[model samples]
Target: MNHQTRLQALSAFLKAQRAKILPDSVGFTSGNRRRTPGLRREEVAQLAGVSPTWYTWLEQGRDIRVSTSVLDCIATALQLTIDERKYLYALAQESGSGATLLKEQLPEISPSLKRILHELRFCPTIITDRRYYIVGWNEAASHVFLDFEQIPSEQRNMIRLLFTRKELQRLAVNWEHFTKGFLAIFRAYYGQYVEDEWYERFLDEMKAVHPDFNILWQQSDVQSAPEVLIEFRHSKAGKMLFHLTSLQVQGSTDLRCSIYTPVPDSSTEYKLKQLIERK
Candidate 1:
């Protein structure tokens, strides 16, 4: 969508959200003979701590600059959910930075990176780009999760697999937590390519394939990649815990390598070893 169209949509969205919230919802006494269904623009502005005129201008879709903080306040005042907040930002496109589309062809993985994946005997490692496309992975990763090679190239997205693949649901002990974190990280990256055709296509496909994905994607939660503890239910190894770490691939701005290592003092290490031996 173009800038004007986006702003218009955002204006409409805010107005709709505001109309959904009744006066009593924000602790106001409901006086008799209310004409409007929800809180007024002035009331929203008061609750959001912004000027009524400014709020009105925003709702009018005027070309006024808005800060992230003000938008956040509005989101809070409106009691927007995580997904709603995200959708708001997606419409606003606050940063003014342009989105760079991915190349038509996938970038080739460096030979050294491939070797590193191969050499990481104990760690389950996978390489992905900013869009979460699985470009490379080690045998350990294939064993820990499903074999990426077996998945069709177009369908080898981590986020897509998490939601659509039944095996992933069975493997992840805390599926909701994992998916939320993944979505947050994905959102963090999404801002950089919000206008890219490929990104838009992927989002459309995801929404079409998984209804829940659309709900989560709207939450507008953005988080940097972080080290996290995750639990997996391995058919052969039983329950296993890993310290999942994401690191940027050196010399590559967009590529990232993720490694899952057994947590210290856990039987996960032994279990992984056993699983490897069975292979």
Candidate 2:
């Protein structure tokens, strides 16, 4: 996006976020009548330790340079989540140069990588792009999860399926927590690609179909891909736990391999073995 557009987006985002905060929540007295829903611009300036005039100018999208420290103060005053804070920095152009660049065209998965995914007979593995599109998976993954082959290629997004696919939802033990992690991770990626049309369209479609998606997205929470333990309930395998590990592809910018390793000291390993063997 152009400088002008970015400034406008920043302005709108600030106003929307401000509208969500209540006076009582921030320890302010809501005496009688209030014109606006959230803290006023002057109140935000006071909390952020800036002149009201300057803050107003910033909100108006005036051509101004915002320092990192000032941005942090504003973020704190707004009670922005980590992902939201990063997004604020990005919109203000106070973040790193890399945040401004568009993602490179996704490269095709190499034969070697496909072989690696296929060779993992025990571990259920799947590959996803930066946007959580399920680009590839192994048979074991199909067995543990749903059959990706049955789903249309265009609709193979992991996030989309997580919300829309009933079978996948049944597999996850804690559906709310499971979906939130994916949403948070997706939100972080959205911050980087705010200018991308695909992200905008995907979000709009998801929000339209699922009310929960709209609500969770408004929270603006963010999380990096960390090692996490996930429990799954399969019809044949029963209760199984897996250590989910995500690895970045060595040569590709977008490709990430997510492997579900059976957690040790549990029946998960034996169950997975039997399940895979029967399949």
Q: Global lDDT for candidate 2?
A: 0.80
- Identify the runs in model 2 with alpha carbons over 4 angstroms from their true place: 1-48, 52-65, 75-85, 94-106, 250-252
Displacement of the residue 145 alpha carbon in candidate 2, Å: 1.2
The per-residue C-alpha lDDT of model 2 at residue 127 equals 89
**Regions of model 1 farther than 4 Å from truth:** 1-49, 56-63, 67-99, 102-104, 250-253
Reference-based lDDT, each prediction: 0.79, 0.80
lDDT of 2 at 268: 88
Clashes of 1: 4
The top-ranked prediction according to lDDT is 2
Worst 10 residues of 1 by lDDT: 94-103
C-alpha RMSD for every candidate: 5.2, 4.4
